[model samples]
Target: MPKAKETVLEIDLKALEHNYHFLKSKLKPNTKFLAVVKAFAYGSDSATVAKKLQDLDVDYFAVAYVNEGVVLRDSGITKPILVLHPQPVNFKTLIERCLEPSLYNAKILKEFIAVADAENQTNYPVHIKFNTGLNRLGFWESDTDYISEHLKATKAVKAISVFSHLAASEDLTEIDFTKTQIKNFTAIADDLSSKLGHTLWRHLCNTSGVLNYPEAHFDMVRCGIGLYGFGNAPEYNTELKPIATLKSVISQIHKIEPEESVGYNRAYTSNGYEKTATIPIGHADGISRQFGLEKGAVFIQGKSAPIIGNVCMDMIMVNVTGIDCTEGDEVIVFNANHTASEFASTANTISYEILTAISQRVKRTFLH
Candidate 1:
């Protein structure tokens, strides 16, 4: 296909499939797969990514909010969707769209129960989130009895799964801590399931958890970053394929003499005559201003061109000095080869931050 847009995020569906199959292979034969498509599928295109995963027979989809799940539903995504952080205001809408909520606290559980009862809903599916060690959302272990009592009394909602988040599942130095979290979650989930008088799907593994802690796979495994081609670890990273490529083109070029600076605040000044190429992307396009000269770079003509000056809202200059490139030549901001992990580390951030920070205005093209 011809280039129809100047700045575009190319999503490789084949690579997504590769990532899905690769992660799924780590789970037990009976274990279910829930693909996280929140944050616009890590800034790729939630609907497109979810549709692809749906075609791959993924057991479930997860988003951070009810509106995201509604979007998937509107796009005809029939697979079960779990809203990780549902608000009381959207509880009715969540039910209307058949999206399950991860009831992390008593307030959410009570509020959702009220809504479900008011709607005359019965045996509604819900996921229970345990605090474990994340200490963010989720209920405390002591709340299990309360939750079970409420479920038994109201019968308004049923717990289909019990899950917890690992705070340091990616850190090898925190292996002991991760084990502790797993043990705590297992104990809580088992107790809750027993009180409820039925089995509950227990899952506590994120991408790193899936790779490093196979023993915690439980009845299902939730894979997020790994499905988009990052393991947060060197060994596992080598086995995955990045599915998003942020690409732009050289819109213009400038030759500046010594003492001339580029971008806002004169953040970068040339000591000698320099050749620079301006690309049509910047902070507004998810390239953080922290990636100024000497920090991050873009790939052009297979050569690295250091970013020059502060990233602007719509443009950035690169020190292209000796690069054999011209106006309109493709410049890869980040992709599989350069890797978002390497790119984001330049700004002292993680790959998740960089990937999810990509702007929606950047047109997306899917490659099958």
Candidate 2:
């Protein structure tokens, strides 16, 4: 990769391939891999990412909404796409596009059936989401009977897959809770499968769950962050490479005299005479306002340059007093060396938030 002339999020297809294979290594040969391409493939151009993954023969792709799946469909993605949080209004379009919906609650399940019936669909694939421990979404354990009855009553929709989300699979301290969630999910899957009178594809593992729980990798595994180079743990992180590198160039350099301030609201005042380099990336570009005043940094000339003052909507000034840098010099906001995870730690956040928060305005270049 060359030095970026401007702010660019470099998408490394080769690295993505490496991470995909690495994650795939953890699963059994017969297990299916579902790539989560929602949030623009973690804010790195979903069309490009999904195309690359499609070429790699990823079994399935998951997105947060029906529109996201439609974009992939328009981009020539032919694989099955699961809309994890689809709405009733888009159910018709979802079916028209051949996108499967994760029918979670009873109302959503009934509504989707109505739409599927209106379209005169037969045995349309739909996933049933059960709430194991993640109270955020999905039906309750007892809702299995309700779901089974509804599916038996309607030939319009079929529960092709039954799944759940893990609440704290990445936290070792929550091992007991995570295990309990898994056990409960298995019970629910069995009960639902027996009630339905046919075997349904069972999956209950996310990125962390895939890494930590091999027994729960039932029929398929949904991997999101792991495919983008995060393993959710220090040991596993060594095996995967980050697929996206956020890079920018110093737009200008400013020499600040003692008592002089930088950025909006005069948030930072120079304690001593120092030099600052302003980069064309800020809150609007996904560098949140929480990352400023020496908390966040951008690597320049292989040296750490702390961000100064309040991060503006369009730019951020970093203290580059000792770094030998000039205008237009390449600046690394976060990459493998000074990773997005580390940078996000400075703001007390996580890699997922930072990676997905990257603005679409940033030019996305790729390396294959």
Q: Number of the top candidate by lDDT?
A: 2
Write down the TM-score for model 1.
0.98
Estimate, for each residue in 275-360, the C-alpha lDDT of model 2 and write its tens digit. 99999999999999999888999999999999999999999999999899999899999998888999999999999999999999
Report residue 185 deviation for candidate 2 (angstroms): 0.8
lDDT of 1 by residue, 1-368 (tens): 34424899999999999999999999889999999999999999999999999999999999999999999999989999999999999999999999999998889888999999998999999999999888899899999899999998886788899999999988999999999999999899889998999999998899999999999999888899999999988998999999989899999999999999888899999989999999999999899889986699999988999998988899999999999989989998888899999999998998899999999999999998
Question: Clashes in each model (backbone N, CA, C under 3 Å)?
Answer: 0, 0
Error of 2 at 186 (Å): 0.8
The C-alpha stretches of model 1 lying farther than 4 A from their native spots are 1-5
Model 1 whole-model lDDT (C-alpha atoms): 0.92
Candidates' C-alpha lDDT: 0.92, 0.94
**Which run of 10 residues does model 2 get worst, by summed lDDT?**
256-265
